[model samples]
Target chain A: MERTGAAAIIIGNEVLTAKVKDENGPHLIQRLRELGIPLRSVETILDDVDAIVDAVARARRRARYVFTSGGIGPTHDDVTVRAVALALGRSVVRLPEMVSALHARAGDTPVTAEGLRLADAPEGAVLLAQPGMWFPVLTVDDIYLLPGVPQLFRLQLETVLARLSGTPVHLVSLFFTLGESALAAVLDRVALDMPHVAIGSYPVFDASLDYRVKVTVEAQERSQVDEAVGRLLGALPTDSLVRRE
Target chain B: MERTGAAAIIIGNEVLTAKVKDENGPHLIQRLRELGIPLRSVETILDDVDAIVDAVARARRRARYVFTSGGIGPTHDDVTVRAVALALGRSVVRLPEMVSALHARAGDTPVTAEGLRLADAPEGAVLLAQPGMWFPVLTVDDIYLLPGVPQLFRLQLETVLARLSGTPVHLVSLFFTLGESALAAVLDRVALDMPHVAIGSYPVFDASLDYRVKVTVEAQERSQVDEAVGRLLGALPTDSLVRRE
Candidate 1:
């Protein structure tokens, strides 16, 4: 399928209420950008089956790829599998291989009766195989179910995402320490002069000069980005600099 | 005005593409919740003046207090002041007191540039009074313009948020370690039993555990919260606990 953009559904109460800062969206966005894909939006929701199902449905309809982080766990709140199944209208059942793999991983934890349910997945769903690993690989359709854990999400996506590649996006960032009020006229002038190079300004609080402006140049060709940044930076105030990423 | 809910808008390209992790939203949400305000949503937008204006306008209509973080630096991308002017249809100009204050703060150095126009603010807007600060303090209606720099946003809010003493919110959390599938039936029982408490499930990922479940109960009374947690915890799969936080 021709890919357009990807979105993320972060399902966890800890994240929504500022209990934990989410890192998956940022991590995925960087990877997607490198692959030349655009990240559309991120929706953070509480750990409710209906909410997850609703968010997934909306994300899939809006984006070419929808990655769900969190909720694919082996606990009371790990409702991703069931919710995904319900969202897809599939029956839930235990896969033999997953059960065996989980049992092997647990050793003597009564995997069959207690932890054996980890093997359960929506009927007809392909198990991703996670024995002594983070997440079981599974692809139902456009959705990729990943562990809510940041490390597990990163590890699993590194392997699964290799199958899906995206086109490169030309982007540039312009950092500025110039007070925003004082730079409006220059920004307006630069933006009016160059609309294609995508001149973006970001405020860096880390700079001692009060603000740092990073002007990024992105284009199909590196030269076009360079030329655009050159022109845009020249039109801006004394503090603008063009940099390549 | 009496507090109802809180929300934040992060405006910047760095966050949009994952170039920088946004810290303002979570910081605000955490502090707001501790003061008993529920967070409705956190939105991230590009560095377009019109976009920022539109978002702030919308937030004013939805939330009791809306905070805009970013674009208040000494750079050309700092369009926050102008955007606030547009949002409220107010003419912006350099306030005399503000320029002198900033000049005093900047002292001698590259910081002085014909006042740097850091004082441009929407006409008749309430100055947040971070005097000597580059970001303008503008309170147009209910929306508050803030610096995207995490620490600055935190400090600036402290200066203005005291006027909005929030009502108290009673809440409790219960964590379950048993895999989600193992606790569905019992969770259903808890939901049926706890009718007054606002129950929400939070699925968390632990590096060592399968998945951790946090069940949050919010109510008017502490006893209600405590009872909800007790019942909710008891209803979970046996032997699944990580302690309430």
Candidate 2:
């Protein structure tokens, strides 16, 4: 693995049980893609420490970067901070910097007796500090810890993503009406020929548009992506109906 | 492995890419549970045939009964049926019985060349037939393929789920405030004591409320589930509050 991108490990029971709509996975996926990093897998599991530790260990081994959302809050189910420590075979201890950051944050709101605990991080973690923001991220061993709240998940990711960004998104999206079965051979050819550009297919249905297919090609440069996608579309049934719009 | 119940596989690029909110997984999870089947796992993937085939194959092997949602529509991205056939090493062809059924259902609606192709399925597959309101389910090796559209997905499921009935959901959830660090030993002991009941933990955060933990236990009977949950909660930290209306 030459370190091209990241994968997400979403640890939360609320998502699996349907109590909360999982926003972390998608939000991170989109942002990571825009930053030119492919999100490999989004695994949602219970808030169990062993499971979290196992997931973290797996992610650390595979992805160039690994980000986790949820379970890092001040409340009881919030065991991500501890679980991460256990995963790294380290002790959970307070980071003085994050504690001061929280004190400055706990200004207007009545920070609960246990709220201060949120500031603590696993020992030797790098703090992606946000004094005003509700959620804070602590990065250790390539894993960035984030809050599950959609708002916090987004804010922290923005601040953190800026620091570890790779390539910028560049590609052309072609939406047309076609069946994949009839075009599988052509797709296989394109995939074989264009190794640099990534092609993804998405099928969508709407009342007005009974059936539509969106083929997106992402690459390091716009010309490379566009040229590869152009070649693939040329082998299709009809190029006229295949609108680049 | 004797099939305990049916499993649901979520197929879509939108879901894997996190572009769209996935309703299929939760919907099928509830429907299958009501039908007395325990859902094994919900796997989301990009609109790639190989990926779809691999996931479908895995699901089919793990659970005697497998239901796939998404990837069976009228667009280029709709490759679920083809993928299933490929995974089974079968060929995709139009089923006359299904074609007639679809023709009758699309009575007033204009049937495009692509629309008629919706009747295609793997050879020798039984039709999980829906009188007129839903897409037909094609079964290959005990795997039932369903549509991705929520409305049609629900209609198609009703016909198949009705075949397997009388499985009541004996699961109760208790949300409380307690950190895992303080009660890891108690949870470990409970896991050993209760061999039958399923235990899971979820962490949730709300704007107005402090983050908390929700623990769920699933069993064959309500009493079994309740007793197990009670015993587990008792071992947790005292003075912790649980979720209430």
Candidate 3:
């Protein structure tokens, strides 16, 4: 079966302003890759309604699954749910199950109006229940609304990953001491020859690092990735090959 | 002076696949903020031509300046320049000055066709030369094409930043032990009252962290930020205020 394409939308003003370093995008990228979902793009947008709506709509059109991080809390800045609802032409309604979960989590503390807002989701959205989860994961159509908090986002993503499967990509990396310019021609030739595989060359400038050029060969098929890596290694000058791992 | 909006397109397959952690986005975000240019969005896209072209077109339409990092090298995956040129209805051309610089850097080594390809830039693109720079930074219209290498990208960005300036934003942060839900109502009231100041509340869940809710007040004017912070402190419960910084 063909692997499904995925895209992510990271919504927050703090992230766009450099006030907060985004941990969600990196985390999702790693996790989604592990789950075999090929993430096509990640867009870090502001907390504005129009931006969120536009990003979500575009991401939905581009990929099979859209994961959104942040802007789902009770705070005024949290507008992901409203934006997604507006974008999909759906109304935001309070989910009774989520309200009960929020009340239970509060224990003796009264659930304030702001806290109850956490229960709101797009109309006809599904609540994903998981073991030991305080709040149920909310999904509207193909978009998954995840908490901005890194821990919560990871927890909810793991549950989502459990239900989804795709063709696992195989990657083979070859490191070289030569600069990318020196290997560019060979890489281009190999890329042209093997259109089935994705070949990438990255120049690492860190003096402390061992390699200068890190070439990666990737494909859904392990044999194709391995063959491409072999060809890349053979094409490189023997002296320039640092290590193949 | 009004702060100009900026957007970034991070073009690379390595970043999207989690094979490489992106250093450019955060680096640019902080640098752009310090330069008083507010970054509106950052889209990490694949090395595909259509993706790069589409992202660049969208970013150009959205912001005053559009910055693209990566896909400027000589390798096959380096398609950013071509994409930008096609998107803007221009053609790519080899830059003689860049070729000379590359030859100089190579010293005794012969400049290969691949190495010379680095000299290619979008039609009518200006090469911004800076002191002690080996390569001139490429700029087409308001779009800056930067390298993927972290050190080189930083160097190029510094040169670009020196030529640009805008109204710097002032930020005041207040920490509280109370959850965001507890402060939501007060935050909404403060946000409504202070239209100029951008108020944001972030919930930090780490037990090791001293504060739960981090409220940020930002504005172009320092006085407005200060005033909003004062009003926010006054509205919050005394016991909930963990620390104000």
Better TM-score candidate (1, 3): 3
What is the descending lDDT order?
3, 2, 1
Residue B81 displacement in candidate 3 (angstroms): 0.5
Q: Between candidates 1 and 2, name the one with more favorable DockQ.
A: 1
- lDDT tens per residue, model 3, B1-245: 23258999999699989988999999999988887888889999999999898899888888989999999888899999899999999989998888888888999999888888889999999999865567788999989998888888889988888888878888888899999889999999989899989998989878999889899989999989888888887887788888777
- How far is B154's C-alpha from truth in model 1 (Å)? 1.9
In Å, candidate 3's interface RMSD is 1.7
lDDT score, candidate 3, position A221: 92
Quantify all predictions' global Cα lDDT against the true fold: 0.67, 0.69, 0.88
TM-score-better candidate, 2 vs 3: 3
Q: Candidate 1 chain A: worst 10 consecutive residues by lDDT? A: A236-245
lDDT of candidate 3 at residue A53, scale 0 to 100: 94
lDDT of 1 by residue, A50-70 (tens): 767776765666578778887
TM-score evaluated only on chain B, model 3: 0.90
What DockQ does predicted model 3 obtain?
0.75
Q: Write the per-residue lDDT of candidate 2 for residues A97-140, one digit (tens) a residue.
A: 76676677666655544566777778878876665664457888
Ranking according to DockQ, highest score first: 3, 1, 2
- For this target, which candidate reaches the highest TM-score against the unseen true structure? 3
Order of models, best TM-score first: 3, 1, 2
